[model samples]
Every structure is written in structure tokens, then in C-alpha cells.
Target chain A: MQRIAVIDYGMGNLRSVSKAIECVADNAEVLVTSDAKLISTADRIVCPGQGAAADCMAALNDANLINTVQELIGTRPFLGICMGLQVLLTHSEENDGIDCMNVVPGQVKRFASPLLDTSGQRLKVPHMGWSPVAHSVAHPLWDNIADKARFYFAHSYYCAPDDQGSVVGQCEYGIEFAVAIAGQQLFACQFHPEKSAKDGLQLLRNFVAWNGKS
Target chain B: MGLAKRIIPCLDVDAGRVVKGVKFLDIRDAGDPVSVARGYNTAGADEITFLDITASSDNRDTMYHVVEQVASEVFIPLTVGGGIRAVSDVRRLLNAGADKVSINTAAVHNPELVQEASDKVGSQCIVVAIDSKCVSSPGEEPRWEIFTHGGRKPTGIDTIEWAVKMAEFGAGELLLTSMDRDGTKIGFDIGVTKAVSDAVEIPVIASGGVGELQHLVDGVNQGGADAVLAASIFHFGEYSIGEAKAFMQQQGIEVRL
Candidate 1:
């Protein structure tokens, strides 16, 4: 059976993510751990997190899992969710500008304050609840999920990749932003598929069966 | 196309079973919280809120188990509220698979608890639940005061001002319930709901009334709520979540169908 490691670096609760993966991938062994040894041996790696970007970086550094994450993203199939996707960028504007992993060339940006939608109504920060994500590029992860599927999102900041071509999916809150990004074997999204219902489960199933190819 | 306005069905769980009451009294059993949650999930609810009305401390553990069971099977966001007194309580619920924790009485007692809990477990998971009642007289400008202990006692705090303070205290969202209309089924108190929703930058969920489908629409269009939450209308099978969303959609409100 294939093994999947969900890296847990003292971040927020990962039970939902691990549980969702287990529910979808019955043939795979899903391990939620921060141990580099077990993580390195896994066939696929999933990085999921919540909270501040600076705190996430600090926890990753203190756990000494930064290098392990960097190496795994290079060779194996890797999925990043929310803060997991933010920390992959070069830097973030949150917590007074914190440096990130630089695994992907991008800058994480906060939603503009006093953000107004097309109707001139003020949009709330954190961008909580479900929003439709429009796919910008086709990939294995979008296998059964329809384009522009509504996914659960809860964040105040978003990633803007330097290379626009790397953007796989986009969603509109105040301004259209990159909600999903890809580079070789790496796929990351700002939305939490684990909490996104049926369409979300389909995406997880696709990831489990993915061969790390575009 | 844009962020869909959320329709949340609240399950008031008491001693491990789902119950509904008219204005916090005259309680009636609905069903199992887990099954009710699953039915709502299948009906296309955007999110689920579990208000633990369990009075005794001994039964609190039952709320946690209910959350664990629902979160395991239901993929949507689950929020647990009631008797959350400290940051530790918030942590325990999140660890139990709840995506968010709503703090009401404790937050009113100590506003700093909001800041501390939001600091410890990112603001995204900290929701400040405000139970307010209109205290203004006829022909007088509408004024609201915060209430505690299931709307039994009144604290002279202004609802709008308190909402602003909670947002400043790092609360990610505000769950505003109008005590006057909570179980009356007349609909949300749009005046206070709009006031609080417009006063803060964080998302506000308008809760407590909601007799019919139009009430849900009005909560978004008129009250400026980011989400609308109702209990009896859903728990009693008055309207399915899909029917509400479809009605809202027909009224030109953006909703996930």
C-alpha cells in the first residue's frame, strides 16, 4: 500500500485533513507526523496549516522540518493547503513581512482594506465561507471536480505568484487572486479541500492517485 | 462567482441530543446531532453551528463527542459554541475537530479572553457570539444592550459598540443573535444586525429569527450579514437548506446552489 505523510509541525489542528485523506484513500496509509524519517519514506506528502504565517515559519524552523519539506517538494508529490501554500511563497506581508520557504516564486499579500465588491458593498476580511474557484489550467488534481467549483476558504491573505503561468486556479474575493498553484510535482491551494464536501473529496482522491505529472 | 453568502443551520445540542427551544425555553427534542448534521450536509448547508445548551458540566463531554462524530463524517465547517470559558476550551474544541469556537458569556465577563484566545489559536477560529436585545423605546432611536445567561440578564453595553470592540479584540467573526426575535419567528432585527455588520470589518452572522425563506434573503440584503443562521426553521423541517438557497438565489442574492 502507498504511504502518505501529513507533516504536522506543531501547527493548528490537522485532524480534519488527515481524516479526510483517510476517508478518500482507503488503499493508502495516512500518517500525521513531523518526524523527518517517516516523512522521507512516504510516497506523497501533504502540508496543511492555519494561523499566522510568521508563527508557521517559526514552528517549522523550531521543528527543523523546513529542509525536509523543501526536499520532499522537490522529488515527491506534495500538496499544500492554506498557510501551507502561503509559506511556499518567497515572502508574506502578514506579521510585518515575514520571509517564507521560497520554494515557489511568489509574494503573499493581504486583501485590500475596505475592500468593496462590484456592487459597492464592503467585503469582510478573512474571506470566510465558500467561493467558486475558476480553474486557470488543467491538471490531474482537477480530474473529476468541475471547473469553478465552490470550495471552503478562510484567510485574510492570498498568494500572488511572480510567474503567472504557475497559477492553476483563481478565485475572486475583492480582486481575483491565485487560489491554486503548481510546479512539477507540487500542487498547493489556499482553500481547504478537507472541509469542502463532495467536490473536495474528489480532489483528494485524485491527489492520492496522481503520478506527480502535469 | 464571488464569495457566496452562507446559510448555516444551528443544532442546539443538549446532553448529546439535538433540541430546539422557543426563546431558550420550552425545549423540544429534534433528533441526534450527528444525524441532523448529516442531513443538513446532504441538503447543501454551507456550514453547521452546534450550540451546546447542556446545563451541567458533566454533559459537556457529550458536546465534544458530538462534534468529533459530526466532524469526522461531515466535510463542511463545524462551529461549537456554549460554555467556552477560556482559551483552553477553545483549544480543546478545535482539537476535537471543530473548525471554530464561539465564546459568549466568558467574552462578556473578560474582553481580554477574546484577544488571548484569538492570539493563541489564530483569529480565524475565534468567533464572538453576541446575544443582544433592543432596549429602545417607541419613537426613540434604536438602542441595543448585551445580555448573558441565555438572555436572562442585561449588561448596559451597546450592541454596536461591543461588536466593534470584539472585532478590535481580534475576533475573526461575530455571531449576532437578536433576543427579541430569536424564537419569535418574525425575522432578524435588521436594525441592529445592519448596525453591527456595517460597524465591523469582520464577517457577521445574523442569527435568531428566520421564520421563512425571505427572512434569510433579508438578512443578507438588508441586514448586510455575511451569513444567515437559523434554528427552528431548519430543525423542524420548515425549509431545507437547498430551498432557502434557491429562494435567496431567485431574489438576486449570491448563494451556492
Candidate 2:
């Protein structure tokens, strides 16, 4: 059976993410671990994170999994959720402009204060709740999930990828931003598929069966 | 805007079993928190809020188990509140798999617990639940007052002012409940809901007095709440989350449906 390792750096909601993957990957052995060896050998790696970018990076470094993650990126199927997606960017405006892994050539920018939608209504920061994601490129992970399907997002900062070709999905919250990106064996999303209900589970199931291909 | 407003089902659990009551009185069994949570997930609930109505020390363990069970079963964000007194309490629940922890009476008493809990565990996981009731003094313009102890005791603090203070204290979201309209089912106390939602920039979830689907619409359109939370209606199966979302969508409100 293919082993999927959910990298845990003592950040974010790891159990729910692992449980969601377990529910869908009936044939895979899903393990939530911070051990670099376990993560390095897994057939697929799922990196999930929440909270501040600086803190997430600090925790990842503290766990000594930073290099392990960058090494596994192209070797196996890798999925990132929320901060998982942000940390891959070059830098984040959060924590006063902290540096992140340069796996994806982009910078994370915070939404301007007092942000308003086109309707002139004030948009809430953190961008909590469900929002539609537009597909930018076809990939295996998008299978069984309809276009414009709503996904649960809870974050203030968003990614601005330098390579638009790598962007696979887009969402808007006061402004348009990339919500999902697909490159080589890497597929990450700004929304939490575990918290996104039925279509979300479908996405995870797709990831499990993807085989790290385009 | 771009984000869809949320329709959340609240599961008030006691001794690991779901319970429901009006204005925190005449409690009755609803179902198992885990199973009910699963039902809500399948019904297309935007999110689920599992509150341990009875927060006794003994029940704390029960609540933890319930949260763990529900979180494993359902794939939506889970907000667990009640009896959360300290940062350690918040950590315990989060470790048990809750996405957010809602603080009520404890936050009212210390106030700083809001800041501490938010800072210690990140603000996004901290939701301050304010139970407010309208107070009408003779010849004076009636104003809503903050109430603690499940709306049984009055805090005498101005509801709007307290809400603003909580937000300043690092509360990511405000779960605003109206004591007067809680069980009346007339609808959310729009006056208080608008008062709090407008006062703070953080997302506000309007709770209490949701009798039907229209109430949910009124919560977002009239009260301007970022999300709407109801317990009895969902617990008794009077309105599925789908029905509520469909009705809200028809009313021109953006919902998960």
C-alpha cells in the first residue's frame, strides 16, 4: 500500500487533515508525523499549516523538516494547505515580511485594511467561510470537483505567484488571488479541503490517486 | 463580496450527548454530538459549532472526547465553546481537533483571557461569545447589556462597547447572542446584531432566535452578520442546512449552496 505522510510541525489542525485523508485513501496508509525519516520515505507528502507564517517556518525549521520537505517536493506527490501554500512562496508580508521557502516564485501579500467588495460593503479580514475557486489549469486533483466549487478559506495573506503558468486555481476576497497551484509533483491550495465538505473530500481522494503526475 | 456568508449549526452538548433548550432553559436531549455533526456535514452545513452547554469539570473530558469524535467524522470547521477558561483549555480543545474555541463567561470575567488565549493560540482560533440582553430603563433609550451565565446574570457592560473591547483584545470573531430573542424564535435581535457587527471589523456570527430560513437571511441582510448560528431548528430537523442555504440564496444572499 502507498504510504502518505502528513508532515506535522506542531502547527495547524493536523488531526482533521489526516482524518480527512484517511477517510478517502482507503488503500493508503496515512500517517501524521514530524519525523524527517518518515516524511522522506512516504510515497506522498501532505504539508498543512495555519497561524502565522514566521511561526510556521520557525516550527518547520525546529522540526528539521525544512530541507526534507524541499527534497520531497518533486520526488513524490505533495499537497499543501493554507500556510502550506503560503510558505512555499519566496516571502510573506505577515510577521513584518518574513522569508519562506522559495519553492514557488511568489510573495505573500496581506489584504489592505478596510477592504471592500465591489458592492461597497466592507469585507471581513481573515476571509473566513466558503468561497468559489476558478480553475486555471486542468490537473488530476481537480477531478470530481466542479469548477467554481466553494472551498473553506481562513487567511488574511494571499500568494502572488511570479509564474502565472503555475497557478491552477484562483479565488477573490476583496481582490483576486491564486488559491491553488500545480507544478510538477506539487499541488497546494489556500483553502482547507478537509473543512470544505463533499467536494473537498473528492479533491483529497484525487490527490491520493494522482501518482504525482500532471 | 467574494466570500459566501456561512450558515452554521450549533450542537450544544452535555455529558457528551447533544442537548437543546430555549434561552438556556428546559433542556432536552437532541442526539449524540458526533452523529448530529455528521448529519450536518452531509446536509451541507457551511460549518459546525459544538458548544458544551454543561461545562462542569467532569463534563470537560466528555466534551473533549465529543470534539475529537466529531472532528474525526466531519470534514468542516468545528468551533467548540463553553467552559474555556484559560489558554491551556484552548490548547486542549485545539489539540482535540477543534478549529476554533469560543469563550464566553470566562472571557467576561477576566477580559484579558481573550487577549491571552488569542495570542497564545492565534487569534483565528479564538471566538468570544457575547450573550447580550436589551435593557430598557424608564425614560432612557433602551440599550443592550452584556449577560453571562447563559443569559441568567447581567454584566451591566454595554453590549456594543464590550464587543468592541473584545475585538481589540484580539478576538478573531464575535459570536453575538441576544438573550431576549433566544427562544422567542421571532428572529435574531437585529438591533443588537447590527450594533455589534457594525462596531467591530472582525466577523460577527449572529446567534439566537432563528425560527426559520427567513431568519437566517435576515441575519446577513438585515443584521449584517458574517455568519448565522442556530441550534433548535437544526437539532430538531425543522430545517436542513440545505433548505436554509437554498432559501438564503433565493433571497439574494450568497450561501454555500
Candidate 3:
């Protein structure tokens, strides 16, 4: 099995991710690196992001490995998580009027509805917690992960893909949004798989297995 | 959107380790923060809060060691508080890799400290952790009294009003805890939680009084909290990270899967 390169752009949680990958992939080696040379040769690439999409994009820009990532994703089996998925979109509502990676045709948006069950009838923003998710499509990532599998989440902004065909999973808060999306071999999930339990581990395992066969 | 509910795991880091408290006072047996963090991450914690309970006392030698170790190990966003007071204290924790530095008693006395730290480390990094209690007698308007120094002293400040003022001064998030429910685990103070969460524009992490997974859902769905924070369940091994995630998933909420 070819080693999977988990990009360490200093934005995503690399340590915990590395550990989870190690636990799941018995044969596949998970290498955390920001080096272009090492990543360019890897069979699979995974990009994970936790903070704001703008900050994550800025980190990618600072690292100067954006183009290398672009080229590799074109040929290798690539996956992006959260902000990594958003950067691939057309732009974001977060940093209003900023051009993104444009890897996918979409725009990241914040949840707009005001769902309030409070005493005063108001809810807060930055929806953070574990909630149910319904699978929208049958993709390789869902090979082991089941419908309604809970994954940890901490973001107000979500990716609304322009191409509905690319969306592989759907989750509903006040409304439905793409939880997981894909373009050929390219895949991404807004939720943090490393933090999610068995389903999350299985999701990572599926990616690893996909990388092995491909 | 309305204020979102949050699922947070409070890490009571005692002497460079994550310990569990029976009530808020009794801290005896607990695991390491790094391991607990990993477990929560896997279980699907929305956000993680590390309360350096003893960071303010004389036994404060390992300020950075504990913060850096846990932060480095987990990939999730973290809010480190409990003993942070000075500007340097905020900077040091942020430097050590904490995503947010929460201030309690400091923000009460030096209200301007909120602006100072916000200016220095960015408002996004400044989390004003407010501990409050309900003093509303049915007929009269609800009074949310603020508690500080670990619920030992009353600040005589209205939590709702203070939350509004703090937001005006540039606090990015509000970490609201119910002193009455710290370790009771009988669900959160919904009224207090609703007030603070509704009053503040930024995210409010509804904490204290989380007994089961249903409380987590209620914290978000009913209380209108952006995030929900708990400790005992994850710490005492009563629940695994996977079960929490699965339970949330069954609730029709959107979580990472």
C-alpha cells in the first residue's frame, strides 16, 4: 500500500489525525508533512482544517504549497475536510469577496435561519456539537460509516456546492447542507473524522482502503 | 441563524493532568487531559474547554507544560481558562497553542481587561467565561448573578447585562457556566443559558449540569446554546466518544461523521 500524506499546513489537527490514521490503517503508512516533495509522491492526500476557512486558506497561501496541492489532486486520490473543502469552493461568505482555491464549484455560507427554543426565543451562532446526519448518497467514504453516524462539528459556515452531483452526504440543521462532497477521486467532509468515534474511524479506514486499491 | 447549541468537554487539568470532580470541590481520580481529549474527539465533542483549576494557586509550576501537551495532541478547537488573569497569561496560553483563552474573575474586576486582551490577542481568542445562578422569583424578572473565584465569591453582576457589555468590548465568545449545576449533572440552567446565549451575539458555550446525552441535545435544541460543555460523563467513563456521537446523530443534528 502506498503511504497516505496528511498535509500539515499548521491549520488542521495533525497529531490526533495522525494517531487515528495509524489506528485504522494497518498496512498503509500515514505521514504528516507540509513538504511538497514528499506529498507529490504520495498515493493519497488528505487535507483537514479546523479554524476559520479564511485563516486556513491564509495558512495554505503562506505555506506556498497550493499549486503543488492543485496538481497532485488532479492525478492522485485527494480528500479535503471542513475548510479544506470550502477553499475548493468558488468563495466564502466568511471573508466576503475573497477568491478561494476553486477546486470545486461552490460557495461556503453561514446558517441563516433563526431556530429559537430559548426562554426568550433566540438561538446562538457557531453551532457546535454532535448531531444526527443523514447520508445523501452512497460514496466510498460511507463504506463502513452508517447513516446518522455522529461526527464532531464546530463551524457556522458550510459548503453549498454549485454542482449538486458532487455532494455525497447531507446534514440538516435549520436546513440541509452538503456534509460530504466528491469530484471523481476527490472527496471531503466538513466534520472532523479524527474526533468522531467508530464511524469516523471507519470513514478514515474507507479512504485508506480506497487509496490502496486505486 | 439563531444562537447555536455547542457540545463541549470541560477538562479539569489538575497538576498537568485532567481530573474529574465530584461536586466542584472534590477532585480525586481522573485521567490525563491528552487522553481525555483524544477520547472526546473520537466521541464527537463539539469543542473542548480545559479549566486549569489549580493554575491560580502556588502549585502553578506546569502552566505551559499542560496546555501545550494537550493542545499539541488534539486537532479540535480548545478554550483554556480557570486561572488566566493577566495579558501575558493570555498570550502565554495562546502561544502554547490554545485556540481561546477564557477569563473569569479578571474580566469582572478589570472590565477593560477584555478590551486589552482582545486588542493584543484578537477578540476571537478572548472568551469571557461567566458563571451565574438564577435568582428569579416567579413574578419578578429573572436575575442572573455572576459567580467568580470558582463560585466562592459573588460578583453582584447581572450575567445578561455583563454579556452584552463584554460583547460590545470585543469578546468573541461567551463561556457561560451554571454554578448551581457545576457537578450536579442534572442538565444545564436553561433559563440562564437562554438569557446569556440570547443576549450575546457571539457564540455562547452552555456548560454545567450535563448528566446524559439528552442534556447535550437540550443544551442546543432547547437552551439555544451554540455549544454544550460537559466533563463527568466523558471523564468517569460513563460514556464513550462514539456513543455520544451516535446519540447525537440519532437526534437529527448535523455532526461530523
Candidate 3 lDDT by residue in tens digits, B109-176: 89898888875555666788888987668788878889887898987888899999998886878888
Query: For all the models shown, what interface RMSD does each have?
Result: 0.9, 1.4, 5.6
| lDDT tens per residue, model 1, A1-214 | 9999998987776888988999999999999999999999999999998888899999999989999898788698999999999999999998899999999988999999999888886899989999999989899999989999999999999999999999999998889999999988999999999999999998999999999988
Pairs in clash, predicted candidate 2:
none
Query: How do the residues A1-214 of candidate 2 rate in per-residue lDDT, one tens digit apiece?
Result: 9999999998888889999999998999999999999998899999998788988999999999889888889998999999999999999998789999999999999887898888887988768889999998888999988899999988878999999999999998888889999888999999999988898999999999997888
In the range B148-167, model 2's lDDT, one tens digit per residue, is: 88789988899999999998
lDDT of 1 by residue, B1-257 (tens): 78899999888889988876323222233367777777778889999999998999998998888888888888999999999998889888898889999999999999999999887778899999999999999899999999999899999999999999999999999999999998999999999999998899999999988899999999999999999998888766777788899899999998988
Better of 1 and 2 by TM-score: 1
Question: List-wise, what DockQ does each model earn?
Answer: 0.78, 0.69, 0.17
* Model 1 chain A: worst 10 consecutive residues (lDDT sum): A9-18
Candidate 1 lands at a TM-score of 0.97
Off by over 4 Å in 1: B21-30
Runs off by more than 4 Å, candidate 3: A113-123, A212-214, B1-11, B19-49, B56-80, B84-127, B133-140, B145-147, B152-157, B165-173, B180-190, B201-205, B208-257
Best candidate per TM-score, number?
A: 1
